[model samples]
Target: MSQYKINVTKLNLWYKDFQALKDINLSIKSNLITAIIGPSGCGKSTLLRTFNRMNDLIEGVRIKGEVLIDGENILDSKIDLLSLRKKVGMVFQRPNPFALSIFENIAFSLRIQGIKDKKKIETFVEKSLKSVFLWDELKDKLKSSALSLSLEQKQRLCIARTLVTMPEVILMDEPCSSLDPLATLKIEELLQYLKKDYTIVIVTHNMQQASRVSDETGFMLLGELIEFGPTKEIFTNPKDKRTEDYISGRFG
Candidate 1:
């Protein structure tokens, strides 16, 4: 495996005639938490989508330069979309649990990969739910519909669904934006534990959350990365004026 779990080089993205990213060159180290922070519509989420080719689904979306995983260009035509997505998992802002049973929600990804053995699926489901700290609460309710879960529980279920695939890199797009303060703290703690095994890139509007969860932080504005470094330095003593302004809440 390469030193960087995901390496983006001179990456620029366009949606029709509107440019959303500009010369975004970033290296995300393996098994670390890197936070992408910026004001709304500053292309933070746009940059995150490029990692797993989620932007490819958007109409008229064009990308320049490369997004590499393990030294291979993921945008290459030879790449398998399904396989790539499995390696690079995504957890959306909303919980988005299927209307199916909770057990089915967690099993969805594994089933798609053609793992039909009941015993293996059972074991994997239990293990994944345990990893997300949802096993005790969800064990008795596995057969219940996912729609019945609370917002926080559903979000953890969504995380369990993502974990079932054993992805190397996980992308979180403002995951805690919809949760309460306590729930948000739980998710942050979960992220700290998760980073010990998988590389994580989170797009968060909460500067404090970024500081709390991320090892490295990138501050972006107007479709450009202004400054990126250790979380403490970027938050306390940013080299760029734009970064300092954003961090100090002078202007979002």
Candidate 2:
């Protein structure tokens, strides 16, 4: 099998007449955290959304490029969106847990797939929570409303909900943006644990978080990928002047 999990070749995107992403190319490795970092409105999140074709939800969006997952082009017109989404689950900037019991939140995906077996759903719920280190704390409160949990707990629960579907890749778009420092640290720790089992791509404006949690880092500027390399190299010794400037607080 190829070491790389996702590949983007000559990718470009436009919202109506305004281009959002310039010719972009990168390869993301399997079972590792890849961070996309840039200032506001630099298309960091836009490129992240392309992996699952989430941009399709917007009106007047045009894309021309190849985004391949497991050697198959997901940008193909005939691709299965439902299956793609199932494989590439997403966690948003804020914890948007459903207004349901904690148990039901995790089981929601399984229920949607027509999985009515109680035993099976129960097993997945336990396993998913365990993966995110929430099983111990939440097992007793399974019937409680998810909204009642603390912010960090809620974010962890959201991640657990994604895990119940057995996705290969997890896309986090500024997942810790709304989190407090302690909570963000906890989430970053969870990312380290998760990298062993799933490929993770994160978009963040937090430079320290990117350096701390990601194995690979890609820097963007004005809708273009300016630099991409091992996190250590990208931070310590970037090849591109633009990347160095951004990393040095010269300019975003």
Candidate 3:
């Protein structure tokens, strides 16, 4: 197997005529957390969506170059988009669990996959919650509505839902943006455990959060990837002048 899980080469994107990404080239390591950081409109989320071709949902969007996941080019127009999305599930900035019971929220996607075995679905639900450390707290309240849970629990449950399909990669787009400091910390710790089993790519505006949980960090600005390297190197000794300036608190 290759060392990199997602390989993006010469990738470019535009919304109508407004270019959102400019020749982005990045190699995300398998089973590790990679964080994309930048100011708003710098293409952090745009770059994240490219990994799974999520940007294709928008009308008048033009894409260039390659996004290879496990040696297969996902950008190929003929590829199975549904299967690609399943393999690369995403967690949005805000927790958007369904208005259904906790159990049903996790089982909803499985139902779409035609899994009607109740007992088997229940087993996978518990396992998915356990993977995100929510099983112990939520097991007794499996029948409760997902909307009744705390913000942190909802976010964790969203993550659990993503795991239910057994995806190879999880794309998190500013997942902690709506959480409090304590809740953000919990999600950060969860990412550490999750990295053991899944490759993660996150777009975070919080520099501290990126420094805390990421193995590698990429700095993007004005639709260009300014610098990408080991987190420590990017934080302590950035080679690019713009990267150093951004990290030094001079400017975003």
Candidate 4:
């Protein structure tokens, strides 16, 4: 199998008449964390959504070019969106847990997929929570409402919810923006652990978080990918002046 998990070639996006992404091209490696960093309105989140065709939810959105996941073109009109999303799960900027019990939230995906076996669902839920390091903390409180958990736990639960689907790729959009510093650190650690099994693509405004967690980094500006390389090189020896300026606090 190829080491690269996702390949984007000449990708472009537009919302009605307003173009949101310019020709974006990059290869995301499997079992690694790739971070997309840019200022606000630079199309970070917009580009992230394209992976699972989340942009389709918005009207008048047009896209051109190819996004290949495991050698399959996901942009094809005939592509099964449900299957695509199942393979590429997403964690949003905020922790949006279901208004259900902690155990129910984790089992929801399996239930919807026609998994009616109670024992099977229970096993999957336990495994999912354990993967996110939440099994011990919430094991005794499985019946409690998910909303009753703290913000950090909610975020971890959101991640655990994604894991139940057994996705190959996980996309995060500013997942730590609403979290405190300690909570953010915990999520970063979780990302590190997750990348051992799943490919991770994160859109983050926090440069430090990006530097700390991501193996590869892409710096976007005005919808264009200005520079992409190893995280260390991108931060310390950027090839593009714009990237250097942005990194040095000259301008976002």
Best by lDDT: 2
TM-score of each: 0.98, 0.99, 0.98, 0.99
Per-residue alpha-carbon lDDT of model 3 for 70-114, expressed as tens digits? 999999999999889899989999899999999999999999999
The models' CA-based lDDT, in order, is 0.91, 0.96, 0.94, 0.95
TM-score of 1: 0.98
User: Could you tell me which residue pairs clash in candidate 1?
Assistant: none
For candidate 4, which ten residues in a row score worst on lDDT? 243-252
Cα error, candidate 3, residue 37 (Å): 0.5
Q: Give the alpha carbon lDDT tens digit for every residue of 1-252 in model 1.
A: 466888888999889999989998888899899999999999999999988889988999988989898898998878999888888999999889999999999889888889999999999999999988999998998999999999899999998898898899999999999999999999999998888889999999999999999999999998998888889999888999889889999998
What is the alpha-carbon lDDT of model 1 when measured against the actual structure?
0.91
Candidate number with the higher lDDT (3 or 4): 4
- lDDT (C-alpha) at residue 73 in model 1: 99
In angstroms, give how far residue 127 of model 2 lies from its true place.
0.4
Report the Cα lDDT for candidate 4.
0.95
Off-target runs (Cα >4 Å) in candidate 1 are none
Q: Which residue segments of model 4 deviate by more than 4 Å?
A: none
